[model samples]
Target: MNIRLLAFSFLISASCFSQGEPFRRVNEFYLKGDTRVIGNTILSEHATKVYVRPKGLNDRTEMVYIDIDADSETFSSSNASLDIPEGAKIKYAGLYWAATYPGAKGKQKTRGNRIVYDVKNKRDRPFDLVKLSFPGSNGYTQVQGEVIYDGMRDEIIELKNAAPYVCYSDITDLLVSKNAASGSFTLANVIALEGYMYGGSSAGWMLYLIYEDETEPLQYFTGYHGFSFIKPENTQELSFKNFRAVERGDVKTSVTLAALEGDLILHGDGVSVFKEDTEEYIPLKSRVRYANNFFNSSITINDQKYTDRIPANLNTLGFDLAQVQIPNKNNEVISNDAKQVKLQFKTESDRLFVFFSAFQTEISTDYYQRVVVEGKPDTIIKPAQEKIAEEIQQKETTSQENVQLYGKDGERIVNSRNAALAEMLKVPALRVPGMNSGYYVVNHVFSKRNYALKWKEKMQLKGFSPVRFVNPANNYHYIYLDYSKDPDALYERLLEYRKLKDLKEAWILKVNLD
Candidate 1:
């Protein structure tokens, strides 16, 4: 028996055994509650060419570096533009970058007349730090990112030779501090393998921005990041819930996807959406994306290819970014009342890795109103007989349920609840310079304190005296109606404020000074 052949057979079987699982969800973000009126933008580091594609097999091509910043001293950098509409508020910003790093000391082995690179002794490096330059900045700022998926640390056997990894960072506070709405953004110091590897070498970065636009329809936005190796025989499904479409006929929905190591000429990969009304899956296709070759390396949104990046290669080699609008051409992929969606990705021949996904859908205007007033009493007037009986019953119940209360000084009070309310109304006791150690019934949140103050004044004009509390941690201002040390009392206040039409989406925030 040949020992080498036996070992190679065993390794192939082990790889097959690990090929069917889906991507692990590492981080997720959702815009609900007070931040439901949101929109999103996705910017990638690659450009879409007209008729050019990369040479050789998708996984065996030489990696090309994209450097657009002349002022930076980094080995690799890329720049892209962001255009946020005026009057829109920046709510959340996420930055993600990925690369394939097959260390320097890889060994070559022969398996069935083919040379295979074995990266068994690859050196480890810091894969969680990157440099970022904001719009109109002179120099790059070093940013420590969170490791979303590191194949070296996770030991993903299927992608061991390529050793792909992705990193993510929440740059909301940084962007908000700079007041960066629209401008050229540069990302530098992205580490990746520059030469050929067992699998194809690829590197790219993406910025996903979610903002609040009151002029646009109310939307529910969700974003997820993970790493999954997609093979020919495997299928990956992503499910999104907790949101529903409006009852109108012109509901709009979209999905954004990003992947690595996809071939431009490869075929047989497809994406599908589950239609709730039809009880079947519909293949998603656009003007540039075909039903059988959905993951081809390109950067397209809503049937339009974006060429707004430096060194805009029509073919991204192995990087893919697409934002496809659902129900295009009058296809009822999602119904008016559907609350959930499942997206399926499959390939019959090509192999790729999907790392990020985002979904957005327009919601009803009255959705928050219905949620706020679900259990509230009706405003209709009652008949004389019923009103008289209810008043008598209320008086008797009040007399029986009266309880004495005491203050911090041990002074007796007529009613416990009313005394607490009176003390709260007398002076703003919970108003602290910074975030206090208590629960706050928050009606609104703003990235800038000035904007928070403006909204507070507007609310005050409408018979509301909301207080503003600043969070030093994230530089966000919390505009709240009430606060208390007791969580139950604060929650009750949240419910009461939610009953009002203007404050229908009020929420609660808890802070601990310690």
Candidate 2:
């Protein structure tokens, strides 16, 4: 990839213009092959012609022309003029250039001698370097556009053909950092000699302003310059958007502020926080290595302050979920201020990698698994209820003169006791193969035949068609409530029995018949 690096800087050169002529001087930079460096030359010193080598002749030549008419007042271009707003801070200022000289046809030929210009006639000619005056020389500057040739290209201009276009340059950081931010400058040109036949032609240039507009909403500038990771060597305000705070126990793990998210895990004895932004202190026991040193910084948005309260690392940032407010007149964060929220946080951690991800805040928690066994039926649970029913039956059979044996009322009383005992018995289903239709719940399983038969007779008395299945492996008999072809109908009946008849432990069992 051909990464086009922008070359821009302020030129504080001595004047070359007349008393009232609007003059602009530019500091020069050259692209030697893939490398870019400041040229020892300036724009105003060349007498006749500015020269630059074409790519066809020398792969090591690229020349930069910067407009350095530094002033604090209003600046204008051919199309636009901007008055320096009151208290407005310039964030980025740039110049745009269009390469019209290396016409579409000029690019097809790789011949080195394609661009050649004769500087013999230096008066009233396009290639001649002459000075001119404009209306805005003193006050409201008329930022007219002019054209010239690349100094590096001129060195090999006779032997090479230049590139077809010159891309735009962004010198915002350089200009802003120096505090020599230029508000206005006359536009100039960087031209290449196409040849004797299609002599001297250059690229078109324009001026544009990128300033901190306080009246407008906040606009976020993203890039290496916009947001940066907090380090001891470097410190800057990081803009945040929709935010949330999450706490697990005494240690606050995560705080979602704006578009940034980071995790906090405190390990050592204790952490003390001293916020430079708010001048607040959190008591500490001792400081750990990575915890105490890294990410212990703060940023103030609005009236609220957020600092690294607990020891943690910033793992991720930049997943905008909600709008946050911009505090100052020159807004640091660019977003809607409608749902503005003030957040104060002091976080700390040992190992931290601050970045941006789609998932804002994620909690990593440990999970557990266990084996669960459903208990057996109460018929199996309470053996005493069955024993009591059997004892009553034995007493009725032995006492011939008892009213329980002779009278219809006595029979009804015995039947009611048997029904109550049957209701108490719970039938758990055992899965069986080939019983695809439907099968009943087996209330009890017995090792002996007599006990199974007795329960089967009791189930029959309880209005259920009981079935017996013998398990060959265990030599035990399984007593089921019924065997039905329709599983759904049997399941419905089972539900009703479980609800109304107190057969709560009842379950459907499938049986296989070969």
Candidate 3:
């Protein structure tokens, strides 16, 4: 019996190690370059004054780097040769700049100027491009051969304090493969001076190049669930590890989730990684927090710290999925990537609800199994639903008796449609002693006099005393709910009636009150 047990344990261990795992690596390199004014350039032609700081100024020490007041200004910089690591090649590169001050709050009506860049390799000619123009760049003219900056911001002041906003331009595929070396670019800021407008930069320009030695195979797993009537003080645990990844080799895995955020009175929320058989929670290797807004809260995975509250209204929940890996002693995720994972939340109030639609990502060798929460015939909201049902049933019964119209003193009167038409036709015409005049406003206008009289009667039945004004020029009648001899007082009454009656097309009718 002991020998048989030992053999069975070896087989389990062998099966666990047989799963295939993919490898992925990411590297970031910064190339901080020098920014200096290139004299004798076209940018200086239309200048009231051009101010370009000396090259290689420390960003912290320098308050302002480049300040230009010219109608057009240009500055040039050369990026140094990249110190490529052995066996690693560049996948992509991004050029970045920071605009520190002279925000929209400044005297200038606009924030950043129409800027363009001239980027090129060491040997080839330059490519003229605009910086981050979106929705289409037809409004802005672009020079030939230059790649426009994809990342542009109209507002420079993003925070409460006057902080600099950074801009990035992707030049990865623009560069000629991994074999290509040095490159250079020139920044041209075209400022239209209405009354001496100038802009400043807070920091120098830099380049971030991402390199990868080898590409890893990617896999995706997705699932969706919507929890309803999740009262406060209830814990909701959703498991997303229904699917399995490739069962061969050890691999590193990270999960990404996108969910709709609804009203939830939850005090705490988090995710957990567990070993299915033993049911042990896996520890995280590290935790990174990002800058996010109220709706887009930052998320922490390891310690399970999450930011942002579930809003009462329907809002797009932009919580960053915390990236975590399989637990190991060396802090490397070498375990089988098929381990089960769950996202959990805790609520202290009885009015909390949480919802998730799906989780999708490109991890190497993953599988997905959908978990559905079946609808209960006896739902928690059956009471509220029953109440609405009762109200609707009552309305249907009362609708029959409601057919009888009543007058102001609660006496049964003729129904509106037939009675209104009959009474209106009895009146010969509108009686105005003098030239019809007053500060009058009309909710509706009609060319036919009979139509106007009928609408007036309809308004009376609804507890409003509407008057009709005749415009002899167009032979039209204007229906007015209120009027005054005092123009100001008439406007005040018109405003009040508009709100009380929910009038959208109401407007003051100008007429000669002779």
- Candidate 2 residues lying further than 4 Å off, grouped into runs, are 1-80, 83-87, 96-185, 194-202, 222-514
Q: Model 1: clashing residue pairs?
A: 48-314, 49-314, 59-200
lDDT (tens digit, per residue) of candidate 3 on 82-170: 34445454455544332222232123233377432111111121223333211212222232222211112223221212222223355
Flag regions of model 3 displaced more than 4 Å: 1-91, 103-166, 177-335, 338-362, 366-514
Candidates in order, TM-scores: namely 0.62, 0.20, 0.24
Which 10-residue span in candidate 1 carries the lowest summed lDDT?
1-10
The weakest ten consecutive residues by lDDT in model 2 span 31-40
Task: Residues 1-514, candidate 1: write the lDDT tens digits.
Answer: 0000000000001112233223333323333321211111111222212224444343444344555566546656766667778767878787888777666334446799997755554545566787888774557888899876666655567566456777888888888887877777778777776544565566677777778776767777666555566666677665776555665456677766655645667677788887653357789889988898776666676688766765555566666666677753332566454567777767787666666666677765455345433634222221322343455456546743254566799887654354444443444334446456776667788997557766765554444546776766577787877667875455555555666667887765656632
The candidate with the higher lDDT, 1 or 2, is: 1
Worst 10-residue lDDT window, candidate 3: 1-10
lDDT, residue 477, model 2: 85
Instruction: Give the number of the best model, judged by lDDT.
Output: 1
